[model samples]
Target: MAAVDAAADLLLTAARLPDRDGLVDIAVVGDRIASNGPASVAARGAIDLGGRLVTPGLVESHIHLDKALLSDRVSTTAGTLEEAIRVTAQAKRSFTVDDVRGRARRVLDMAVRNGTTAVRSHVEVDPGVGLTGLEALLPVREEYAPALDLQLCAFAQEGIIRAPGTEGLLRRALQMGADLIGGCPYTDSDPIGHIRTVFALATAFGVDADFHVDFSDEPLHMHVREIADQTVRLGWQGRVVVGHVTELAAIPPFEQDTVVAELAAAGVAVVCLPATDLYLMGRGDDINIRRGLAPIRRLLAAGVPVALASNNIRNPFTPVGTADLALLTFLVAVAAHMGSPADLRALVDTITVHPARMLRLPDYGLVPGCRADLVVWECARAEDIPATLPARTLVLKRGRVTVEAEHRVVERWR
Candidate 1:
C-alpha cells in the first residue's frame, strides 16, 4: 500500500465500506475523515479491522428518553396506547430531576454501546411533567457530547390545547436549549390547533418540527395530511418529520398513495416505530390480527425518506427494547416484509443515512471530509446486518473510539 503525504490522527486499515468492494484504509485527521483508499497512512494510532464492514454510525431518529424504562413501576393489563400514556402520566407525577436523569442516562448508555452516534430524543413537555424532563436531559446531553450527538425535542406527549399552559412550557424549553419542538395531534381536543401551534413554535424558533401522528390500527385520525399541507404552506419542507403513521396501513391503497404522494411532495420524512406499533396496534382483533405498521416499502418506493426507530424502551408502550437500531431493522424486515438484498440494505439505511438526513445532521458519512463517526460490524456485508444482527466490533465518534466489544466462542466438547 502506498503512503499518503500528511499523517493522520488515526488510521483504520483493511476495513470494508458498505458500497465499496475490497478493503481500504481510512485516515482520520482531527475529527474528520481525511481520506479512504487502498493505501497506508502514517498515524499516531492504528486499528486493523481485518476486513470487517464499516458504516456511518447509526442514528436514532425518534425516541422517548424521559419516559423510558417504566414497565416495572407502572402496571398495564390492557396494553393499549391510551393506557400507556395514562399510566406513564401517573408515573410522571412522582418524577424528580434525578429520577428523569437516571432513567435517561441508562438508555443513553445502552444506545452508545449499540453504536448509535447521533440521537433525536423527544422529551415530554406538558403540564404533567413540567420542565423536569428538559432540565434533566440538558446536562445529560452535554455529558454525552463526546460520544453522541443528542438532539432534544421538546415534545407534547399530552394534549397541547386540552392541557393548558403546555404551549408556554414548550416555549420555555426551547428558550433553555431544546433543538426542536414536537406535538401529538391525536392526543389533543383540537388536533389541528395543536399542529398549528407546534409549527408556529418551530418557525418562530427556526427549529424543526417532529410529530407523533396517526398511531392507530385504523384510519381514525389521519392528521398527516394536514401536517403535510402545513409543511408545504409554511415552507417547512425537509424540516418536518411524522412518526408512527400506522393509520396509513389501515386506509385503502389509493388513499395511502395519495397521502404518500403529498408527503413526498412536501418533503416530510416518516419514521416507522415497529416495536411500539406492532405491540399497541391490532389489539381488538380475535383472529387474523393486522400488522399495524406504516407503508414503509411504499413510502420508500415513492422517494420519501422512511426511517425505522425505537419510540420507547421497556415501557408500557413497547414493553421491551435494547436501544439497538439493528434490532429495529430485524423487526421491520419481518413485520414489513422487506427481505430482498436491496430492501435489506435499504433497511440498514433507515438507521444510518436516512435518519441522519431526517435529523439534518451536518457532515455525516464515511466519505472523506465527513465526520469520523463510524461503526465496524463483525460482518463483511451490509445485507447481513439485519439478517444476522452482527455485533459491533468498534464504535467511533469524531475520530475517538467510544465503545469496543469482543466476542469469543470456545468449544470444550470438541
Candidate 2:
C-alpha cells in the first residue's frame, strides 16, 4: 500500500508512444501521469530514455501461479490434460506454504522482469487444496505489491456441483481477498450448475467472473453463448471474463460468429491461452488435424474484447512458460497468423491496450491522467516488438522503477 505514498515527480524523456502524439516525453506525479509533452518543463527527477518505445505496463489477464514450476517435481510420461490434472492434484496435498510461495515468487520475478505490472492469477480452490493456495499467495501478492499488482481468482479446477462443498470454499476465498470467482465447467459433472455457482458467488461478493470454458477440441459441449446470455440476464456485463474457449475454433463458422456477436453484445471479454490449449487439445484425434485456439481475429472483428497471456508457467498444464508475455504475443503472431503490418498493430494492442481494458486496470497507459505503469523497451517501432522476446527492458510500476535491464555492444577489435 505504501507504493502510493512514495510517488515522486519523475519525468521520462524522449520516449515514443505509438498511435498517439508521436514521440514525446512523459511526466509522472504521485503514481499518475501528470503530463506527456516537452521534457524541458522539468520535475524532481528525470531519466532520459533516448527514443525508447514506451508502452503501458503489460497486463497478464490469465495465469496460474499455484501450479507453476512443478513440472520438475511431478513426472508425466503422457502430456495429456488428464495426467496434468491428476499429477497437480496429487502434488497439492504436499504443498507446504513455503513450497507454494517459492515457486510463485519465481513466476512473479519473471513476469516483472518481462514488463508485467498487473496480473490475474488463478489459484485452486477445491476441498483438496482448500485455502492453502489462497493463503500462500496473499502474502506473496503483498510482497510483490510494489512491482506487480496480483489479482487472485479462486479457481474450482476440480469441480463445483460434483465436489459438493467446493462452492463454499470459493466463497471463503473471495472473503479472503480473492478478486474473482473461477470455474472449469469441463471438470464438473453439471457444467451449467458450475457456471451458475461461479456467477452466484461473484454476484454475492460483488466481484467479477472468469471461467475456463470449453477447453476441448470438440465443440459439442460449448457454453460460451449461454454464459454470454447469463451475463446479460444478471447484468454482469463488462465484469465477466472467460478464458481458453478453444471450442470456438472447432464450432461451425456461423455459430462462431453468433457466439462472438453474443459476447460482444453482453460486453464479455475473452482470453485465449494458446500454449495450454494448443498443447492439450487434439490428443485423441490422430486421423484428423485441428487448430486448438480461440478465434482472436473473429472476436476482435465482432468487437468482443480479447486478450492473450501466459496462462501457465512450467506446470503440468503447460510445461514451458517463462511468465514472459512477449512470448505469448509472439505466439499469437505465429499461431494465429496475424503477422501483417496492419495486424501487427492489433497484436500490440492484445498485450498492452486491450488487456488493460479487459482487466479494468486503473491508471494504466501513457496518458496524462493514467498511472505511470509503463515499459520502455529497446525498440524503435511497436510493430517490430514481437519478432523476438523482450531484450533490454525497463519496467515501472506506479511511477517507481521496478525493473531495469540494459544491453550494450562495443567494438573492441576496431
Candidate with maximal TM-score: 1
Looking at model 1, residue 189 earns an lDDT score of 99
Q: Against the hidden reference, what TM-scores do the models get?
A: 0.99, 0.95
The worst-scoring run of ten residues by lDDT in candidate 1 lies at 1-10
Candidate 2 residue-wise lDDT, 197-227, digit = tens:
8889989999889988888887867888879
RMSD of each: 1.1, 3.4
Query: Where does model 1 exceed 4 Å of error?
Result: 1-4
Question: Which lDDT tens digits does candidate 1 get at residues 305-355?
Answer: 999999999999999998999999999999989999999999999999999
Clashes of each: 0, 1
